[model samples]
Target: MAATPAWPPRSAPRLFVAGPLVQDAQVTIEGGQAHYLSKVMRVAPGDAVILCDDETGEWAGEVNSAGKRDVVLTLRERLRAREAVPDFWLCAALLKKPNFDLVLEKATELGVAMIQPLITRRCVADKLNAERAATIVTEAAEQCARTALPQVAAPVKLETLLRDWPESRALFFADETGGETAAAQFAAHSGPAALLVGPEGGFDEEERALIRAHPMARAITLGPRILRGETASIGATALWMAVSGDW
Candidate 1:
């Protein structure tokens, strides 16, 4: 008897597709994705490629044809269902371009449900390139094999965020000045929660007062050493996941 190879080999390249995936359905891969598969991976007919539709789940796929401009795939079988992300959100103050990009990438990898970019008085940047930010997070999710993508919202003013925040969700404010320990606060609240991180120079006195006065806000500190805006966002998100999320 001859041994058969695994259905989808471990070396298969995973990707997130747009449309819903159904068994025996054909999916067209174009643009950069086509280049990666045809030119980079050099996947020929019958090669396996894993596909994930954010709505459905993960699916095993087989490359049907390959061309310079497009690669067609046939959906084989359902591998896994869409991942259920935690109810946590990262409300991060906008930092420099590179720094904010880092925040978006790591937040997606950490599996936060949503990313809310905040515009604070000390923020270096008041706007975010939504398309660029989406691409960054999408790539990060694809690399991490995430079946679900985090919702990224446009940058909003700090006061507006505080004002519109849901009362049911606990907001853990990462105040540079001081407050309760992050890990402890996160462990104490296992319900729907969020973390608010300040910008480069940290939040101003008035902004700090506003956040502190908000009923849903609970001031928390990362540690003795001060961290940059991106660091705080990433670190606090990871911590919350470990403590209260599906870690």
Candidate 2:
């Protein structure tokens, strides 16, 4: 008799569901997820899969029912508990669709706790498709084997973000004008923090003043050479992960 393949295939699919999960429970996966499993992956009853509720860690389950529009799986065991993600947020000014999408993907891989889209005066893409962004992050987390999904908030104006900034969270502003190196800035501070990256055209003078005046803001320079909006966001996140987060 052949041994059962690992409950979750070596390449486990990352799923986002709403709930508090329990062992030996039944879960019904529907919509695009169902279509992917049934038609794309051709998963059948008894096939193993991994499930995550974004609350209760990762679980190993087997397909109990498979249909065109819906698939049901019964929880067999807990594969791993939810991981503790870094207390870091990427508050970036909206970029063009491509760049913004890249930020969302990489941010998830970097283990950011949240992704806050900021709309500055110079921002190129003020409107964001939340559903698509969520999908991108979900796929990214799955590929990177991340247990927790980073929360993606809707795009808000820069002023609003600064006005409502949480006092306890440090805001590392990547100021293109001038400031300390990112490494030095990160080394000097610790605890829940956020890195704010400006848009493509960069922040206007008025926007810059608002950011600089924010009590929680700390200006940090990426380097002498200017980096693209997406590059700055990813680079800052990577630095923070290495210096402060779980690398």
Write candidate 1's Cα lDDT for 1-247 as tens digits: 9899898997898888896889999999999999999999999999999998799999999999999999999998999899999999999999999999999999999999999999988888899999999899988998998999999999999888988999899999999899999999889887899999999999999999998999999999999999988888998899998987468
Q: Which ten residues in a row have the lowest lDDT in candidate 1?
A: 238-247
Q: Top lDDT: which candidate number?
A: 1
Question: Number of backbone collisions per candidate, in order?
Answer: 0, 0
TM-scores, in order shown? Answer: 0.97, 0.93
Off by over 4 Å in 1: 1-3
Candidate 1 — which pairs collide? none
Off by over 4 Å in 2: 1-6
- Mind sharing the TM-score for model 2? 0.93
lDDT, candidate 2, 127-210, per-residue tens:
999889989999898778788999999999998999899999999999999988899889888789999999999999999998
